[model samples]
Target: MSETRTRVADHIKHSPGVHFNELVRALDLAPGQVQHHVRRLLSDETVRRAEFYGRTHYFPPEFDAWERGTLALVRRETARDILGHLLEHGDARPDDVADDIGVARSTLEWHLDHLVERDVVRKERDLHNRVTLVLTHPERTTRLLDDVSPSLPERFVDRFDRLLDHLVEG
Candidate 1:
């Protein structure tokens, strides 16, 4: 493999769920250059791609479906914040998570849906049927969060979601 491809592979191996834009920024490579190398890497099976929540995240071949999904979701700041909050608080109500994370309830629900769907989070109901959010795999999620960092696009998406929530709520 070329030096650039090796660098890209090593990055994905270390980072696991890094998106394209994040890879470009972290490696300080041009977008087109990264895209080119990524394509070659994919063709060569040096890295695998997982698409979730409108972002294409690259991972090493060793990551399973659950790891890929969890890593991908945690790449979004709000989702990571939610996971971290749940990890710290044990189990929490939807409103509490939204308030603690400073995101609108709608935004939190959107992320929660993804998390729940992927089995990363579990949503239960109380006697009154009030919703409670809990991390289904807190330790694993926390460990993966250490390896998965948000990309620039993921950050922008999170900000845009918050902005939309503000505008809608207002």
Candidate 2:
């Protein structure tokens, strides 16, 4: 799998239903560039889109395995990274996470939502309208064995570095 495709898939797996602009920020690609790959992914049936309010969210298919195709190479590493972050931080809000990790807010939320849906992470909204996140129940035995693994730790690290670089570059 090409690194860009893998990165896009990983981004989708982490944060499903993400918009093109958010994807551009998360993966550090241009808007048109991200849209191009997203269009291909949609055509390939590797991704599906949904509408929430006025926004469209792109997510992996319900029974479609992420382990196949371009994503297989980095799934384990990604899961390890996500899991490590949850274990270390306990819980966090999506926006805070995006800021901390250097990915766009919507992008981080996509990942958080995916983690929640896949049983890798749990999510709850508070009275103040803040979404709290934590690792899912019956924690993953290992990153490799999940029926589906949305590796979070590696993503955390990768985006964190990117965030740092973004800061430095600016």
Candidate 3:
């Protein structure tokens, strides 16, 4: 592998679930340059890609489906905050989680939907029909959180993507 491809692979190895733009910004490389190197790395099987929640995330070849899915969701700040809040509090009502994370209810619901779909979170209703959110795999999610901390720019991109998704869906 070329030095550039190796560097790109190394970055993805350390920062699992990093998206293309994040890679460009973090490596301070031109977008086209990063794309070229990333393509080469992918062809060489030095990394793998996962598409979830409207983002194409790259991971090291060793990551399993669960890890890839978890890492992809946690790379977004809102989702990570929700997971952290749930882990800290065990289980919480939707309103409580929205309040604790300081996000609007709709935004909270958006992230919650992704989490629930990934099976990292579970939603249960009491007899009274109140919804409660629980972290289905707290220990695993916590461990993966250590590996997928998004930078400020990545967080901005994630929020922007969510906003676009909301507007389009509406």
Which number leads on TM-score?
A: 1
Evaluated against the true structure, the overall lDDT of model 3 is 0.86
Instruction: Tell me the TM-score of each prediction against the true structure.
Output: 0.86, 0.38, 0.85
Summarize candidate 2's per-residue lDDT along 1-170 as a digit string, tens digits.
Answer: 57798799888877654555567777889877788888888889888876533546677885233322112322334334455566667787665555555555544554555555555666778899777877554343234334334335545655675566556645
Task: Report how far off residue 42 is in candidate 1 (Å).
Answer: 3.0
Model 3 lDDT tens row, 62-116: 9999889989888788888888888888899999987777666778887788888
Comparing 2 and 3 by TM-score, which wins? 3
The numbered model that scores best in lDDT is 1
Clashes per model (N, Cα, C within 3 A): 0, 13, 0
- Candidate 2: regions farther than 4 A off: 1-80, 141-170
Residue 101 lDDT in model 3?
71
- Model 2 clashes, total count: 13
- Which ranking of candidates, highest lDDT first? 1, 3, 2
Estimate, for each residue in 1-170, the C-alpha lDDT of model 1 and write its tens digit: 89988999999999998888778889999999999999999998989999986879899998899999998888789999999899899999999988988988888888998999999999899899999997888888989989877767668978998999979996
